[model samples]
Target: MEPIPNPSSAHPITEERPGEAPIFDWDWTETLAQSWETLLLILSTFWCILLARVVTQKLQLHDSPNLCYAVEFGLVILPCILLITVAVDYSNYIGFVMFSGTLWFLRKNRVLERARTRGQFDLGGNRHMALSVLRALTHLITAINILAIDFGSYYRPYRKSLQFGAKLMDTGIGLFVFTMAMVSRRTHNWSDLRRIAVYSVLPLILLGLARSATVLVLGYGQDIHEYGQHLNAFFTLVFTKFFGALLNILARKDLHLLPLGFGILLIHQFGLSFLGVSDYVMNDDVDRTNFFNANREGLVSLPGFVGLYGLSIYVNRWMVASSLLSYSELVRKLRRLLLVVLLLWSLFVISAYGIGISRMTCNLGYVIWMLAIGSTSLWASFGAIDFVINSVMPWESSPSDEQEKGLVTRGTVAKGGDKSIVSFTISQALNQNGLTFFVVANVLNGAVNKFLRPEDRSNCESVIILLVYMFLGTRMAYELLKRGIRLA
Candidate 1:
């Protein structure tokens, strides 16, 4: 099946009145508190993972796949959706989760101690699974907020801005690009670049074109300032990929990717700050008569994304190496990841004071902000998943031991060894077949908007609709996994 263009940014939720203003024409992005609050919402998901691990282990839920998935969905996925859309006071929810998790750990302190002393409890599970979890959650959250932002129940402060600010929705695109960079790293030769341009880059451009055509033909309401007159997220992906590949060729093999990435980011930052690119892009008064002016947001934002792409490549390289490490080695790698997060966050704090965090323009602060979020998210997932596996498996029969005993084999979340870790399986399915999941999500998002009128719905109705949509989309991903179908 031909994949549907993702409707994340091209949403047509409500009709404009004759003289009514555009829905996405907000003056500035929401405040740091709002963005941080929403960003910290991921902690709820981490809590869910930890809690679900305990519940499943206690009940021996992995004996039945159906029952296991049901528990995971109820505990991990459902609450994540709620936290993103309807729930307020996010810190409270996170705190409650932490308290509950602490109590459970305290009760199992003996088991944990025995496991740790026996050299069994350690952060040595599959790092690849950790990366997959991070990617899946990012995709899932972006999918949820894209539709939910149109609803009355959804927080208005989470909406993307036309000009500037670190809003949740706009941050979604940057996060997506950052993950793409992490996953799509390569040392492209001339032939490889040509092949990538044809096989990889061409399809993304076509996808962008398809979305543009779809919006025009279906008469979906579009905000020109979001990606300017004709571009969309796919185009941004293409630009980032093109530039990243071109730069890789220029850098050759000797130069380290991290320093090269930093240089690109510094140059981009200079252009945005010292050079007038930021002013030109943010200036609404600029006439959209020329092609450059028409797609200024998409064009001007490319360098920052490319810089982000380079940074992710370096990080991903580190992750790939860490995947093969032992427990002690993995701990050192985790510390390195933490340092990366702290450094990026420190840079973001300093840069935002000067250049300001503008996801619209993809400014220096925004790049660091995204890199920080991406790294922090990956670190959290890695630590959490590793903790769950190490803490849970020592008490029960480890999957390896289970196989030796001829017992029911625990399922593996990622490739490599049989850790038999309990995780959000829906995320595994979605990560396994992301293109299919996103296509299904975007098409359904449009269908829901067309039929249900999310903006008019009550809070109760909105939550119900979002829950149903998430269930169906993830269920479809699971079904596709069962069929061994990867649409991309």
Candidate 2:
């Protein structure tokens, strides 16, 4: 789906909100109603998996440490596309059959066997967790995005889902930037930002300008700012990268610089509110729609997300420690990490209860919630999964250890590799070439929205069209990864 501008920091807070409208008629009720049977079936399928995991662990049914990574992607990600694209009417019987088969398609995702390496808690643990959640998030959005609507209405029960769903795409974008910046910090000097900015951000500006011009010149006025594909480009190229560069300067590669970035983000969040910035965006229809909307969204709403990038630096520091420790010592660090997550969650709860959720204005509450939820969930998930796997198979062998014994790193790996078969294809593809696929989605969306009649399409037709679009994107991603190319 095309990115909307500064679409108020995202999910739980934006239910049927008034400011933004969708590109198409998205009846939340209708969409959910039509899909509920299938939805319930999917949830049940997931439930069964969870139950099976518990059973396996309890009974020690499968001592295979690698079973931690087993999952049926064909069922989890594929059949949903198939069901939606062809508009197959949901039948409990058919769903049962399909989902049952999916249960049998388990494959290794190569998740971490240990939470720590040497003496420190491994940051790679979070990488695996984020990759899993992010891929699932990507796939869900890609599926629903076929209709090309934001589903931003707060009026629906799915308001929370809608908001988080939309927010996930950009959050993923910001998360990666922060993570890579942590990586880059170890390699590059501060002075390299200008060169990096030019190489990265400039292309986005040019592409955005080109897309905007196409909409303006060709009379494609619908969601013009968004359709032009500039919003994400601005966030990724400008705010995410450039702003990060400046912050990196201030951070001076010192871990102490993290608190500074965090402090600055807090100031930005609260200072703007005190200055009536939040009031203006929330109440001023004209300015909100203009400044906060697509055209110059980067101008108004990016600070919080940029600040998020800033905070990620501190988080990376927390996740990555100098001490290489034994497994028991790493568990101590995990306990402390869990404590930090609780504190963050407390902040989120206080902020939400105190100020209420508002995306229209990038309020302090919004900032706290996103940062707290995002960071906490990542760490907690990592810890939880690592704990479960380790407890289940204390002697599990990883790829490195297995290789010493001449075993394959990944079992019976396919041509497209683990990414294609392990998790959802769309996310695997998007992860491989997020920027390129994003550009492709925008260009293709603009064309389809301009030329095609979404309103007249049957449900099955919409599903098929979206599936086709996602497939092409996936193919492009596979090819790009195979060739070792990426715009990002």
Leading candidate by lDDT: 1
**How far in Å is the alpha carbon of 111 misplaced in model 2?**
13
lDDT of 1 at 304: 82
Tell me the tens digit of each residue's lDDT in model 1 across 372-482. Answer: 888888887776655435444543334454233322223343222333534456666776667667766776777788778888998789888888888888888876655
Reference-based lDDT, each prediction: 0.68, 0.45
Kindly list the per-residue Cα lDDT of model 2 for residues 1-488, writing each as its tens digit: 21332333322332335665221112223322322432343344333333343333444423232332233233344454443333234445565764575445322322233333323333353334333443334334443443334222111222222212313222333344444443344214555777866776686676666656655655554432221224533444465667766776667555755676667667767755456554433332333334334433335556665666667656656665543446776577768877876786567555544544333334455555555545554554445344433333323224443233322222211122122112222334355456566556666666666676655666556555665665565556545644446665
